[model samples]
Target: MRAVRFHEHGGPDVLRVDEIDKPEISAHEILVEVAGAGVNPVDTYIREGATQPFTLPMIPGIDVGGTVAAVGDGVSGFDIGDPVYGTGIGKNHYGGYAEYVTVPDDRLVQLPEGVDPMVAGAAGVVSGTAWRALIDHGNLQAADTCLIHGGSGGVGHAAVQIAAASGANVITTAAPTYHDALTDLGADVVLDYGRSDLADAVRDAAGGGVDVILDHRLHEYLQFDADVANVGCRVLGIGENETGVGFERSSATRRKDLQLTMMTMFNTPDLRVPLRKLAYLMSEGDLEISIAETYGLEDAAKAQQHVIEESFLGKVVIVP
Candidate 1:
């Protein structure tokens, strides 16, 4: 089996494709013949030594979609040849940047009928994160006006659709080029963050301020988010700045009595439920996963570099 391994943290240069032994599954785990692996910013951070507590020769990826190749003892409700998709490895074991991956039975969901494996892999982490942030934590409702920062990116895009499907008014920030596409994805309004004051734009779009905010660029947009949130609004911060930057004190949030929360997708103990919900949405055509690009398994280095270079819509997948 071939896998991407980083013996030392640095840049994309640290990733190398090497032939490694296939992962052996424990009694509670299952072996998957990986079809696709999703790449994310955290993978790059781990590669660059930005995220810590990882050992050398680590395999870097969490989301994977594949077919069950073998099942370990005590694994029930799933069998060989079942199509499954969800977060894999990465947390405490080797991850999905490989030909085969060992995954705990609890973390995966059976792919819904007619769902593509690539799309499932792409939806794995981002969709689950969006589900938790907007529905579980933010408590978004039908009457709420929601502003999603970086709406064209992976999690943001998913948030837009999820919010819209729940009957909330969805506002999002993106480049002008993606505005129309995002609108089609359920964003009621799209603000060009590069050209306009996001706070003002959001306020104008929502007729004063929004009821909820899904913030992906925390440090870059936190104050602006606070400025444009309605009184007692909820703001969910999804991404963290790498530099540990601080925000200036402001009376906007204080005066409004806003509720702000920061969330890491991994903080959610289990992804099985969220992934199943997202899978149902995908299967029903109520939601769609955007895959920006796909690369060969051996091109993990290039894929990670692509994620670091610029903001792209949706996810980048590595097909094994």
Candidate 2:
């Protein structure tokens, strides 16, 4: 089997495709013939040594969409040739950037009929993160006014769709070019994040402030988030880390009784919880998965570079 492995983290160039022994599954795992794998920001973080990966000589991928070639003895409800998709790859274990990868059965979800495997791969982390932030953390209601930052990116795009489907009035930020496309995806208002008065723009659109904010670009918009949150608003942080940014936490806390949620899927150990709901939504066409680019499995390095340098509109996938 061929796999992408990085012995030491530095840059995209560190990734190399090499012949490796096929992974042997544990009793509760499944062997998947890799079809597609999603690339995310954390993939780069691990590659660049920004985050401490569980192991070295690592295959860096978190989500996959593929056919089950075989299942371990302890695995049931899934069998040979079943199409499935889910997360739990490349996190202290082998991932989908190869000819074959082993995954725990619990982390895999059966794909719905007619859902593209590439789309399923893209939905794993980004869509699940969006679902966690808005529905799980924010507790968004139908009449809520919600602001989604970085709306044209992977998680942001999913956030827009989810908020709109829940009947919330959706406001999003992106480059001016993506405004029309975002509106088509159910955003009630799209604001250019480059604007100096973005807080005012959000306020104007949502009648003075919004009830929930999904802030992907946390450092760039933390203060603005504070300004635009309505009374008792929920502010969920997805991408940014708190150590880099400093703001007046007391004011937001005292003034609006805001609830701040900083999240990563790793914070919750169970991948199955979000995967079930996300799979159902994808099956029903209630959620959309966007693929910004697809590269051959051997081009994993190039794929990682694209994720870092490009302001791509959605997930970048590696098709093995």
Tens digit per residue, CA lDDT, model 2, 199-284:
78899999988899998777877777878888899999886655676465656556877788988876656788888888888888
User: Cα miss at 7, model 1 (Å)?
Assistant: 1.5
Would you list the clashing residue pairs of candidate 1?
A: none
lDDT of each: 0.84, 0.86
**TM per prediction:** 0.96, 0.96
Mark the 10 consecutive residues where model 1 has the least summed lDDT: 243-252
| Candidate 2 segments exceeding 4 Å error | none
Q: 279, model 2: CA deviation in Å?
A: 1.2
**Candidate 2 similarity to native, TM-score:** 0.96
Candidate 1 structure quality by residue, lDDT tens digits, 40-87 = 877887778877625778988888889999999989988899998988
RMSD (Cα, Å) for all candidates, in order, is 1.5, 1.5
